[model samples]
Every structure is written in structure tokens, then in C-alpha cells.
Target: MTGEVRRAETDVEREDAFAVRFEVFVEEQGVPEDLEVDGKDDEAVHFVGYAADESSDGSGSDADPRPVAAARLREVGDATGKVERVAVLEERRGDGWGRAIMEELEATAADRGLSTLTMHAQTPVEGFYRSLGYETTSDVFEEAGIPHVEMEKSLD
Candidate 1:
């Protein structure tokens, strides 16, 4: 539950994010590997979360920071951004990492003068986004063979 979430600023960190996506989307959800990594990664702003004290030896001191979650955001209109590829490792699902990730992303977007944030969320997890101040903006639809719907939040 304790970690740092920030916009990915290094190639290594971005790779970590991609690895998390592979774990959640491709391995767990059966999303085709071919469709998981889109061409937008190079230009999209990516976010990664890393734990400072996750340890296998139970010491929990100075262990290597491990990537736990990832997300992508890209500015679409003059004052809006599209968030995509949100992924959280199975172990971290109930610990608020997802919300923390979005919080960090929203903070970045707000700082950049973005007025809105948008995302296509899977049907089952739409409630999670709703809790974060997003509202459904589209009927249920499918993306990558998964049922999803567009959600949006004004950044005021």
C-alpha cells in the first residue's frame, strides 16, 4: 500500500509498466498479446507505481523497488487526455494501488492544464472508476474482445 506513483520518466520504468500490463491483460485476462502493446506507447505519457519495501526475505528494508501497476495517458484535444492500459498486478488489487495510480495521473493532468480525463473501462470495473469521480459516457462496447465503456471526469 506504500509506494510511489509517478509519470514514467525513464525507459526502464516504462518497460516495467509494460511488464505489468502483460501480467494483467495478457496472462490473466486472455487479452491477445499482439493487441496489448499498441503503437502509442512511445508518445503516450505512462505512469508506474513502485513499492519501496516489498521484500522476499521479510526484512523490508532497502529492498529493490518493484513495479506494481501501470497506466497510460495521452492528450487528445486541447484540454483533454485519454487514459488507457491501466493494469494492476493481482496481488495489489485490493490495496488502493489502482486509486493511487489514478490520483497521481490526475494530479499530473491537472498540473498540465488538462480540463478532462477519459478512459475505456471494462464493464465489471466501471464502478471503480465511478468511485473516482468518473461518469459513464458511452454504452457498453467491446475493445480487444473485452466489453468496455467510455468514462470521463472533468478535471475541475
Candidate 2:
């Protein structure tokens, strides 16, 4: 990906990350309101991606980055990091922002002492996650009114 992706260090920064996710998953994709903003948001580490050209808006700018993406990672048990709320702006799909977000999230998971990364990927994008080394672990299921599949990848 040509964009720079990094973890948002503070609560306010994480909220901006969640805003991007809400734009895509809740507003655009029709994910349920309750599902889109789960309790995990308070506990997970959030990541945000912006086009290299975008100015550092001093933490979490409300302005849209040229190419924006977001995701959250939470510790699952003792060794796994669960990734959730991954989203990229509609116009930025083909530009590799999604993959950049995934890579950044994985790196964050690794840095947090997690040995595995897991996510429930929307069915349409399961292949994309698979290409990133995530392997399906369950049959298709409905989540937030969308079909999804559980997938996991080893951090090692």
C-alpha cells in the first residue's frame, strides 16, 4: 500500500478511527448500529491509515485523509488478537489501503505479545483476507446483517 498506516495512541484518536469504520460498515454497508459499536471499542487498540499526502491533523483530525482506513485489535484469551471493524473508504478500495490496514493491525498485534490474529471477515472480502494469510475457521454466518466467516492467521 502507498499509504501510511499506524496505531492511534489515545482515546480520541481511536474515536476517529471508529468514525471511519462507522462510515463504511454502519453507514455504507448497513451493519447494525449496536453491532458496529461494540464494547470492545473501549478495550481494543485502534489503527488508522491515511494517504501519505494527508497532513498530520494533530492526532485525529475530523477531516478525511485522502485515503482512509481503520481497524481495532483486542486481546483474545492469552495468545490471540481479535481484529474487528476494518474499513476503507469506498474510493480507496483499489489503492491497497485495506491491505495496508491489515498489515498495520497485524504488526500491532505482534507488538502486543499476541501470537495469532483472528477476525470475522465479511463474506465478500473473505478471499482478500485469505490472500493476506488468514484461513477460514468456520462456516459462513450472519453478522450485523451481513454474511461473515471467521478467519485466523499466525503472527509468527
Candidate 3:
């Protein structure tokens, strides 16, 4: 959270975001690559959070910030946007990167005139989303072989 979070504006930035997701979702959690790399990227606004204290990419450059967390926001109509693909490197958890990313996404949504945000959160992390003001709106369900619940937060 001490570093910076920015909307991905280049192919390389997007790739960095995806790399974090692949490490967390596909490699570490056993999610299939196909499911993790869904075709919606092109229509989403991706955000990448960087940490300057350490090198997440193994580049050994402490001075250069490296992507450590990522998430995407895509408008889903009725002035609401869906938050998706949230991921933080295993080493970066508990460092506030997840909250930082969500804050950035919420700020962007507000700037876009969105009145609410939604997400299908994995059950294990439902509490985390709730801490950010999201309320569960659905019973537990399965997605990508994991249990999940739909959650939403009003931006108004």
C-alpha cells in the first residue's frame, strides 16, 4: 500500500497484472489456465498495484516497483461495475495490497459515475470483502471449482 496502484494502460502493464493472477489463481490454487484467462480482459479496466520495497518479479531491483496485486472492473449496467480477478502474490498478503487495490477500483468507479460495485468472491475471502463494505447477496455457489458468493457494495 505504500507504493502505488494504477490502471493498466499498456500491454505490458496488463501482462504484469495477469502474471500476478496466474501465480495466485492458476499455479497456486490449481485453477485451470483457461478459466483464469477468460476472454473478458479486453472489455475490462485492469488495475495493478505495485510494491517498491521488494521485487515481486524477481528482477532484484528494490528501487523499481513491481506488480504485486491486481484486479479488474467492468461495467455491468445499471450504474454498477463488477470487480473481478482480484489477486495478490502469496508473499504480499497481509500487507494491505488487497485493500489498496479495491480502494483504487472504487475510486475509478466513482470517477466513471458508477453507483455500485459487485463481485463474486470466493467463500474463503468473503469476510475480507465484507470488511470493505460489501454485503453478500447470494447463497454459496461454485465457480471455477471453488465455493463463492455474490457480494456488492453501494458507491453512492
Candidate 4:
């Protein structure tokens, strides 16, 4: 539990974030690699939660921080934000890393003066988001063949 979550501020950090995303969505969830990484990454701000005691590649190298979870956010309107790519390593789930990523994204949203924050949360994880003050705003819908629902929160 000795980890810090922060925005992915470097290209290498961004890659690490994507690696976590790929591990969760593409490798474990059976999502296509091509579909897992949408082009929106270029315009989104990414966040990563790194465990100080864990190694991402299992090499145990201190030079590279192990990123356990990741998420991204982008402006959808003048006062609205969209969240995406929320993922955590299977081994890291339920350790608060996912919520850590969400908190960082929410702080970023509020910093940018966004009044509303929205996301397409996988149906199975809707309760997780709900615990963070997000409310389901739309009925279940399929995205990438997986059931999802739109959720939102007001930054005010």
C-alpha cells in the first residue's frame, strides 16, 4: 500500500500507464489490442499509480517505477470532462489503486474548471465508481462488446 498516484508527466510514464491498461483490457479482458488503445490518448491527460514495493516488469529494478493502475481524462466541453482508460493490474485490484487514479483525475478536472465529469464505466465496476460519488446517468450499453453505463459527477 506504499504507493503514490500522480499524473503521467513523461513519455516513459505514459508508456507505463498504457502498459497497465493493456494488461487489464487487452490481455485479461480479451479486448483486441487495436481496440484497447483508442487514438484519444494523444489528447488526454493520463494518471498512474505506482507501488513503491512492486515492480511492473518483475525485474525488481529500482530505476523503473512499477505502475499498478492508470486512467485518463480529456475535456469534452468548455466546462465538462470525460474520463477513460481506467485500469489496474489484476494483482493490484481492491488495493485502492483504482480509486487513487480516480481521485487524481477528479482533482485534475476540478483544477481545469470543469463543472461536470463523465465516463463510460464497465457495468461490473459501476459500484466502484458510485462509491466515489459518481452516479449512473444512462442505461447499460455495449462498448467493445462489454456492457457499460454512462456515469457522471458534478465538480461543484
Candidate 3 lDDT at 56 equals: 56
Top candidate by lDDT: 3
Writing each residue's lDDT as its tens digit, candidate 2 over 63-151 gives: 64543788888887889889888898887787888888888888778877899888898999999999999999999998777899999
- For candidate 3, write residues 15-54 as lDDT tens digits: 9999899999999999999999889999999999888776
Q: Score every model by TM-score.
A: 0.93, 0.87, 0.94, 0.94
Q: What would the per-residue lDDT of candidate 1 be over residues 51-84, giving only the tens digit for each residue?
A: 7767434456546677889998899898999989
Q: Measured by C-alpha RMSD in angstroms, how accurate is candidate 2?
A: 3.6
In order, candidate lDDTs are 0.89, 0.82, 0.92, 0.90
Per-candidate clashes, comma-separated: 0, 0, 0, 0
Clashes of 3: 0
Worst 10 residues of 2 by lDDT: 58-67
- The parts of candidate 4 lying over 4 Å away from their true place are 57-63
Residue 29's C-alpha lDDT in candidate 4? 92
Q: Hey, what RMSD does candidate 3 come out at?
A: 1.4
Model 4, range 1-156, lDDT digits (tens) per residue? Answer: 668899999998899899899989988999998898778898999998898877667776645669889999999897999999999989888888988889889999999999999999999999999999999999999988899999999989
